[model samples]
Target: MSAPTHTTTSEPFDFARAASLLTDAAARAGAAIMAHYTGGTEIEIKADSSPITNADRDSQAIILEALKVLAPEIPVVSEELASDLTASLGPRFFLIDPLDGTKEFIKKRTDFTINIALVEHGRPCFGLVYAPARSLLALTVADGEAVEATLPPDEAGADLSKLAQTRLRARVADPDGLTAVVSLSHFDPETEAFLSKLNIAERSSAGSAVKFLELARGRADVYPRFGPTMEWDTAAGHAVLEAAGGFAVAADGTKLRYGKTEAGLRNPGFVAWGRKAGASHH
Candidate 1:
């Protein structure tokens, strides 16, 4: 069967509804993570050497169920389920990371996140990143459209109704200075050499998909990854960054696309930078 179609009608973007659902989902996932965080759960390695826990599976199930209820028609491609559905997706779908930063979570750090992105025609049209422990939610819809909200205590469990909205924008300090964001966990020697060549002034280290959020909020300038990442790892972040006048592209300058192959979902090394960087670098 074909995947369900996403709504294109102009029926007002439901920021409130989206926030509530995402916050609740994040909180639910967070609780699961906390349970494992106390340190009794076993950890197993995926073929890629990534760690997986009961928290990841439980959280993914929670997010998947919540998303289905919130937007039943939208198809979902969550990291936990990608292997099963990767070959069957349609033009538009939701890319989700239920427990992004499982490594961090296992380490008892608060760097994990719940990521959701709306991908249409191989590009993200909307994106949301929820960090449950921090009670933070970052959202971007289109160009000049973005909001950062905090989840309320009362509705912390998938409540789609109590998110307090706040505005967010990219921070451009020098406009000419090269600021780069590199991975805190996946940094490599080659990526370091690349940044050195650019003469970057400010460097930021963030875990999970929050690197994309940093770029979206203008907190950092550029992100260059020479290693590997799956489509789900960067799709949502790419959407938010693109909406904020930034983009994540292959090192060769092609826009990142998803649903390519199953043998390897690892993405090519890419550079993410703002509109100004495009003029100077690309």
Candidate 2:
């Protein structure tokens, strides 16, 4: 039997419904991840020297299965399955990072997360980031409606509405000083230089999408990354941050866009801000 598909229609896509589906998928993936987290899994190195584990594959499989039933027509560009990054990607697609912080996960850190997002015309319209080990779920339920909830990874496909949620909003930067969230595993000299240019009063290091969560939750004012990253690594978090009244941009101050097929889906250095500060800061 053929897999089910969501029929294409002229009617607008229901983001709230889609968010529900994604939340369930993410929760399922989280459960799968925690299984490996507790049982322990072996790691292998990819051609790029990045690490991969069975947990990543298991999570990817669960999410891909859910997405297939959700909207099969929309091609999925996932980190684990993307062998050809230079290939053309149309205006809309689903992006997935089954595991965003492989290094941290291998190190037994709780900062890793599962990321899923819908990119339309190079902008992420919906996104979900779930840190299973942390029991933290952050996502955009609808346009301009972002929230976080406490959800244990063992709960398979739990209904999001039943969980108590905290609305997310990025805090404005303090004129005198800013709190910067930097990469814990991928910190680079350029990121240090970028922070130096700002009147930063505090700094914290975190792994994976957790950095984005900090800004979304008003715990940090900015996140700067000069290291290389793939689209899947940041799209979902970017969507969440944008929904929470924040924005991300390249070093040149232009908006960060997805579907960079020519660039091999690789991202340039970018900065995420709680609020768009003056150009002087960038």
Candidate 3:
């Protein structure tokens, strides 16, 4: 008997395809969240006493299931479900925050977001942040291209490929022209003290990771975060900013990296800056 011949034609890695899938997954999660947003937003307290809504759980389920199909080989460390990020993660993994701003969500604010990112070698390499209320999506497709896009206002026929795309650019801003974006609800004096030293031209406040977008788009120059945060909180936003030619750094000026198991997924005080925003941000 003749030996059986193997004819396998595997496709090359498709960055665009992966990005589209991730974006579509975010859209689905967004829809899941919207369903609850329209109904009663019953709130539950986590061990941390932070708010958790049905929307968060529902969205997490949608994203996690999609990720299983999208990249079954990799593990996911999601904020709503993961108990230990370091113990649960590898050099390559997915990090997600199904609903990043639950307080904002409860308050009926649009700043809440759905975060998804791929972390490799302690760096956020690709990510997508979908603001379902705003119908905005931002991502990097592993091509070093970061973009902010919009799906159709109509959610039912959402298509990531049909997204209107605008490549992001972190514009240069000197100290005198710099505007610092701070957390609207969590801003502390330490962050204010840090910003004061820069003498930034303006101060603006917003909730959640949307500040990352402000920096990535040149709408703002710097973000000083001095309070507690988690890896999932920043990873997706960090990937988008880095791909847009900007960076986030600790107060000590070390570039922020992911998978800090010792810290229990918590992040230290840090400053995120746009391209050429100046050394003061560090």
Strongest candidate by TM-score: 2
- My TM-score estimates for the predictions, one after another, are 0.85, 0.94, 0.91
Candidate 1 vs. true structure, TM-score: 0.85
Candidate 2 Cα deviation (angstroms), residue 120: 0.4
Candidate 2, residues 1-282, lDDT tens digits: the string is: 121232343325467777778788888889998888888998999998999999999999989998888887888999999999998777778899999998999888999999999887788878999999999999998777799999888645888878899999998899798999999988989998888888999999999999999999999999999899999999999999999989899988898999999999999999998965564546
The lDDT of each candidate is 0.72, 0.88, 0.81
Which of the two candidates, 2 or 3, achieves a greater TM-score against the reference? 2
lDDT of 3 by residue, 1-282 (tens): 121121222323355776877777787788888878778778999998899999999889878877887878778888888775558465677889999989988988888899988777687877888888888888897546799987533344356767778999887776566788999889888987887778588888888789899988888888989899998999999999988998899878898978888788789888898896344545
Stretches off by above 4 angstroms in model 2 are 1-11, 277-281
lDDT of 2 at 114: 98
CA RMSD of each candidate after superposition: 3.2, 3.8, 5.8
Report the C-alpha lDDT of model 1 over 1-282, residue by residue, as the tens digit. 353333455434354576556667767776776667676578889876788888788888887887887788778887877666436566667888877888887777777787887766676767878776676777763334667777522224745444566566565546556678888899999888888777577898878888887877778888898887887888877776776777777888887777665535568888887655335554
In candidate 3, which residue ranges exceed 4 Å CA deviation?
A: 1-14, 86-88, 152-157, 277-281
Q: After superposition, how far is residue 82 of candidate 3 from its true place, in Å?
A: 1.5
Candidate achieving the largest lDDT: 2
lDDT of residue 109 for candidate 3: 88
